[model samples]
Target: MESVSKIRLWILQEGRSIRSVARATGLSRNTIKKYLKDDNPPSYQRQAPPARHKLCDGFDTRLQELFEQDQKRPRRERRTAVRLYEQLVSEGYTGSYSPVQRFVRDLKRTDAGSGEAFIPLHFAAGDALQFDWSEERVVLGGVEQKVKVAHFRLCHSRKPFVVAYPGESQEMVLDAFVRALSFYGGVPRRVIIDNPKTMVTYVSRSKDRVFHPRFLALMNHYVMEPVACTPASGWEKGQVENQVQFLRGRLFVPMPAFDDLDGLNDWLRLPCEELANRAHPEYSARTIAEVFEDERAELRPLGRAFDGYVEKTVRVRSTCLVQYASNRYSVPSRFAGQHVSLRAYAGRIVLVSGQDVIAEHKRRFTRNVSYFEPWHYVPLLDRKPGALRNGAPFVDWQLPDGSLSSAMPR
Candidate 1:
């Protein structure tokens, strides 16, 4: 690997004889003589550095700023990475996706560590139990309906509970949590969850999650901390996620049909409780119940029963009845034309006008024409008798003479 200049100087100054050059340079005699007349250098100088691309010129700072902004806002309007990418593109960023994706990936990795800042509980010592719902299908009265299965698994015991309900609304979600807490005989210090709109209203980029006010109020009532998982990492709540599939197969595979939600819920509870008490299939000495017993002491005792509150707003109609899920409910005549909040319980509907109980009725199971009492709808008939023509009270308004003109002007 001698320099070309050095080789040439050696050849010119030390006598260009091939044998003499080879002896002086320590190169093979034939090699030294061949290079003495050759004109070009070796061809190994073409290696170069990789190309540079900027997917996010200033996104790290922007992402940090966005996360800070989200802290003061509701979860429903938080900025997502996908949303941020669109924003970046609009700002005339000329970078390709790889860089953007890479930056986001790193950002999320850091956020994951920050988001998991939970006070770890000891195994078998009442560690935080998390509850959630995953979409499932079950047959109700011979019809297959889409539903969300309520799922709860003790972090320490890994003892899981599941119940299927018709929808993912707030009432159903909260109902499931109450039942799970009751079955466990206590509430964990913290209940972890994924961001369902029912519970979490927003997620901050700092990984702070904003819970719905009513939901947070429920947590406060139960004396348990509510921890929400990072939005995209479904794996953060993997125990319940795994139990969802397990329960789906073990409980719902045969697709048991039932008369109603109560019947189905009643039936689903037994086997799940049995499964929890039974010895672990793989672990000989431990049962789910055994592990959960240890977790119970770490949990906070239930405060006042949730009162099974299902908060909903309904406007009073002209008929003095509030429409709820395609069904009509009667309020007192005094509440007509005013907006009211309805608290639907298992057996009653409590209509509250700003902390004042305006009206309450036994909740009706049937969807069509459910009435609280004769008096509730009597005012409607009194105001407009014709309104009862297609109502449940239509026959009650008939005159003994079998004439429609009994009370009409003759």
Candidate 2:
């Protein structure tokens, strides 16, 4: 091609004769003249050979069938590409593994879900808020544990609030809502969330949703509509999804260390405020915090905060302890063999008998631990002083002075 172009250029542009070009280029006069007569450069076209069947030519149907059949089997029991290749080889397949690998790759690409279409969502001031939970690993109290972070974002202002929890239980969800509402200083008209079991108990095929009874009460109290996204469809609330990713990368990537969940949440306050104060991506002139100030006027005035706790009734054992989350908490001996209402808060547990608060203890995350208030068993110990020598509840008892300890026998 280069030689042809050179010959054409020399004859047409340089005003050189074809014979002179042929003499200098060592080409036959006939070839040089042929190129010179035509203004276009010399071109070569190679015709493709006739197609022929290869050893793996008809394997597409077979692979599709095999994959469809394997779909009915458990995930761990399904066949891999290599295993399929071996089976094909045993069945008289004469092709190399490369073709099979390419076929499998193409099949997976074709079978993947189609690209999703996203609509640009617009929100009025304080119209809606998105809520979600994201998991992160962090060192708390010198121990590494996976923590669930609750994320809330106001759609219009892009204002965000985040808090860490020990788990994603119903109690944590409600507690997060209370904290977020308080932080935002008001409640949005609607709360958007995924179809978590704690909130949405069921969704019919027609998209009719049934929320948990307690969650319904919460919605009623807040005077906000509860909007649940379709099951497995997270993009319905895309704002909070993006916020979760932003927080994981910006805040939790280094795996922040704190002495407790409270400390971690307190540390998050400054970052969250900074995020709000940053310039809004869409509203170039105003920051999120400034925009939120306008949205605040649109929000509903929040009434007294809800007592966000999960309540259950448990029978007090003869040990004068009520079991909650596989751990025992001591109550007054008078409540023994009686049913008491156990209210579980994010940071503490409160036990109530009838209308009186009988006991309160710091919430424990670990299992098989017992919390005892020595005062709860004092009356029983006074009645049966002999049992005090080796009571399970008194195992770690210590007297303020050395005199009382010396009077008791070991």
Candidate 3:
């Protein structure tokens, strides 16, 4: 192109003769004349592709069909290139696996959704919040375990709050909201979440969700709308989804060690606060904390927490205890033969009968261990004086002063 441009400029613009242009440019007059006649620049032509082998005759079409079918199935159930190759071999295709593998790879790269672009999302202050759960490994009480960390991010301010729970149960989801809302000092107009069974019971064909009743109740109490993301759409809550990775690197890395979940949570709080001191991701001039203050003012004022609990009705056994989750918890001795509502919260279990709370015990996560309140058996002692000798609840009971000897059977 450079030579052609110079030649044309010398002849057409500068009025140089074709013979002089060819002589000066070290090209034959014939080549220079051809260059002048053709208006388009010279371009290289690619070699024609070699013909495909006989075995690939119907293989490309079959591969396309298999890939299209896999796209409709669940991601985990999708066939790999090797699996597709195996299926093709079973069907009597004599071609090597390389061609089949290449075709699948090419199809994936050119799929309709693969090459598409997404519009950048913008949020008004207090407009929405994104919630997600992440699994992080930490040392707690000398044991290395994975903790479920609930992450909450305000869409506008990008301020984040996280709390670790033993597991991601329905009650833990509620408790996380309580903690996050308290940290932000207000509630956003709507919350965006994934379609987890804990939050969403059903997602209709049109994306309408039948949110879990208790979860819906909490939203109703706060006058907030709950938004469920499409089944596999992590981009809907992309802020929190990204936060989970960012925070795992920033906070959980180096493996923080704490004696209890509370201590770990307390340690997590300082980092979260310090993060706000950094420059905001979008508005670099202002710190996240500064922007958070502005967004906080736009937020709805924080109200009383929802009394979130998973309630179950169970009949107390003969031993003055009720069972939940394969474990026994003592209710009041009087309710041993009666039915009571067991309200399970994130941290405690409360047994309620009618308007009365008969017994409350710290919730336990372990299995098969019975939790007992020694005082619940005091009334039974009067009728069964010999009970203290062999009762499981009294085994570790600490009697006051000399009361053990005085109360013993004489």
Kindly list the per-residue Cα lDDT of model 3 for residues 25-120, writing each as its tens digit. Answer: 899999888888996798878799766543366888888998899899654345677778888999889888888877888888888545646678
The C-alpha stretches of model 2 lying farther than 4 A from their native spots are 1-115, 401-410
| Between candidates 1 and 2, the TM-score winner | 2
lDDT of each: 0.71, 0.85, 0.87
Candidate 1 segments exceeding 4 Å error: 1-124, 281-283, 310-313, 345-348, 353-358, 361-373, 380-410
Error of 3 at 251 (Å): 1.7
Residue 112, candidate 3: C-alpha displacement in angstroms: 19
lDDT of 2 at 273: 92
Rank all candidate structures by their TM-score, best first, as comma-separated numbers: 3, 2, 1
List the candidates' TM-scores in order. Answer: 0.61, 0.70, 0.72
Across 1-410, the per-residue lDDT of candidate 1 in tens digits comes to 44666777777776577677667678787766566678465455748867756545576677567566754654333445555566677877666666666666676687666554434334455757878777655677788876667888888777777777667677767777777888788877788898888899988879788888878877888888898887777677777776776666466644668876778888878887688877764466989777667667777776667765777788898667887766778787667898999997644678899879977786664566756444555555555777667676455654467444443433
Candidate 2 local lDDT, 3-77, one digit each (tens)? 888787787889998778878999899988777677676666869965644435567678777777866865434
